[model samples]
Target: MAQPKYRTHVGMVDILPGEVEKWQAVERIIHEEAKKFNFEEIRTPILEQTELIARGIGQLTDIVSKEMFAFERGDDQYVLRPECTAPVVRAFVGHHLEQRGGTQNLYYIGPMFRAEKPQKGRQRQFHQFGAEILGSDDPIADVECMAFMISVYDRVGISNMSLKINSVGDPESREAYKQALIDYFTPHKDELSEVSQNRLEKNPLRILDSKEEEDQPFIEDAPVIGDFLNEESSQHYAKVKQYLNELGISYEEDPHLVRGLDYYTRTAFELISPDLGAQDALAGGGRYDLLVEEVGGQPTPAVGFAAGIERLLLACKEMDIELSEPKSVDLYIVTIGDKARSWAIQQLPEFRKKGFSATMDYAGRSIKSQMKDADRENARYTIIVGENELNEGKFTFRDMEASEENQLPLDEIYGRLKKKL
Candidate 1:
């Protein structure tokens, strides 16, 4: 017989038991925080029309230009969603979620696909939990979204993160800033990285997000969007900062922090953890007032943020914060004979029905081996029943943790275990 191939694809990972517990811990916090903020859950498909991302994320952006897993399907082109915001917007438009006319607070937790080189805290298939607030352009909405993001990090025990924020302004202001960037970077075009050189002509704002070492020196001096913010955008940014200060959240204003998305306007922010090395951004979002309109819906104002679950766990690990372990079964039953095995099967379901996690050895192993397996499962108690014990109508009840043993009637065992558990 041939051995079956058993390997995960490149840039993807299988989350085994131990690590999955940590992921659950983070997800619980995400759900809990979302509820507290009045954000309902919305799940969108993992695949979306290729044009949705192209139009939403912008054609010149690296995610659309290079990293999306796009392919032709029949008469249409589809791509595994590289991000969720665009798909969520597509859903909002398709479902007419905004026709009723009030703000919709929605959140989602799922895997996003991006065809990028795998690295620590990054992969082709990565998970993100994000929230979107649609309908209101108020600065308080931006503050609320940011506060919720910070609260999630706090609840997850990731405290040493820095929040860097900036305002890219409205479209008119952004265009003026873009021209300034082109004018400034054009003089040093010969020295800029190849990617930045292309970005300069295509979408100069992307040059600010470039990680190219050669581009850094020139990028730092290129242009500051804050300098060109119009009256409305400037006041909106100021109010967001004011509210964040009132909420006592410390943040740094970064002139070059334009998020790597075309839809963002007015406010942009990123939470960075020093522990994540080169991939330091733990989460990021901003106001995208034009996204809905861009995706064929009414012009709606919205704000959102997405944090990488892998990055959050990495931050927790660096801080030496341990997540609570999943609870194990209350008891493991060891049956030493056929009669005892039948008796064990009868009692197992009763224990489970009574809300106690219960299990019995089905492999018919030796008592010692069964006990070892029980220990590995971290069972709080172990019940050993043998032919003699079953005949005597009593069983050996052992407390795994305390290493104490007691002989109890078979009928009385369930009640006693229930109380102890």
Candidate 2:
């Protein structure tokens, strides 16, 4: 037989049992925080119509241009979703959810696909937890999103983070800035990396985000977006900063933070930590005000942010945050005789139904071996059922943690454990 051609590769991962608890605890915190902030959960298809992403997310962006996993199905082509906002906007329009003229706060936690060279805390397929607030352009809304993100990090015990923000400006100002960027890079065109050189012609703003060592010096000297911000964009950015100040949220204005998405219009921001090597962004998001209108919804204004779960988990490990302890077994049934074994088996379901994490010696080992196994599993209570005890309808209950033992009738065992547990 031929071996399978595609085995698990470097960029993929399988979450094992020992690590699953941390993942679950993180997810629980996300949900709890989202609920506290009044954001409703929304699920979008993992596979989206290709054009939805190509148009909604921007064809010039790396995610749409190079990272997407595209395939054909019947008459239509589809791509695995690379981000959450685009599909959520599609759903908002298709469902006419805002016809009532109200607002929607949506949150999603799921896997996002991107075909990038894997590194520390990054994978080909990674999961992101995100929240989007649509239908409001209030600068306070932007601050709220930022605050919520910080709160989530705090809840997860991640500290030593710096918040960096920038205003990408509305389409009008962005185009003007894009022209300036082109003119600035035009003279240094030959010095730019091949990837950046290509970006210069398509989306010059993306050149600022280039990671190539060769592009750094040139990108640093390029025109700052803050200098070119028009009146409306300037005021919007100022108000956002003012709100952050009011909330006592410390932030640094980074003119270079053009988030890697075409949909972003104004107010792009990232939460960074020095602990993460090259890719230090623990969470990132920004305003995509024109996205709804760009994608055929009524001029809806939106802002949102996303944090990588794996990266956040790494941060927890680096910061030494403890995850919730594993569940403890309440009881282990140890049987010494065939009749006692039969009786123990009969009593197992009732013990479980009474809300106890119970186990029994399925190996039918000696009582000594069973006791050792029970200790290894950290069973809180051990019930010994030998021939004499079974004949008397009584059992020996030993407390592993307290190191105490008691005698109990089979009929009273459930009630006694209920009180003790």
lDDT of each: 0.90, 0.88
Error of 2 at 398 (Å): 2.0
- After superposition on all CA atoms, what RMSD does each candidate show versus the true structure? 1.5, 2.1
- Candidate 1 collision pairs: none
- The prediction achieving the highest lDDT against the true structure is 1
Per-model TM-score on C-alpha atoms: 0.97, 0.93
For model 2, state the Cα shift of residue 267 in Å.
1.1
List ranges where model 1 is wrong by over 4 Å: 1-4, 99-101
**Backbone clashes per model, in order?**
0, 0
Output the worst ten-in-a-row residue range by lDDT, candidate 1. Answer: 410-419
lDDT of 2 by residue, 1-421 (tens): 9987967866889898768878899989999999898888999999999999998888888888898889898999999888888999998888988875667888999998888888889898899999888999999889889988898898988877999999999888788889999999989999889999999889998898788999999988889988888899899999999999988999999998988788898899999988887778899999998888877888889999998998898888888888767656899999988988898889889888878889999998988899999988879899998899977877898888889888888667777788888
* Candidate 1 C-alpha lDDT tens digits along 1-421: 9999999989999998888888888889899999999999999988899999999999888899899998897899999999999998899899999876689988999999999999999899999989899999999999999989999999978888999999999999999999999999999999999988888988989889888899888887777998899999999999999999999999999999999899999999999999988779999999999999999998899999988988988888899999867557798999888998998899888888888888988798988899888988889998899888977888899888889999998668788876777
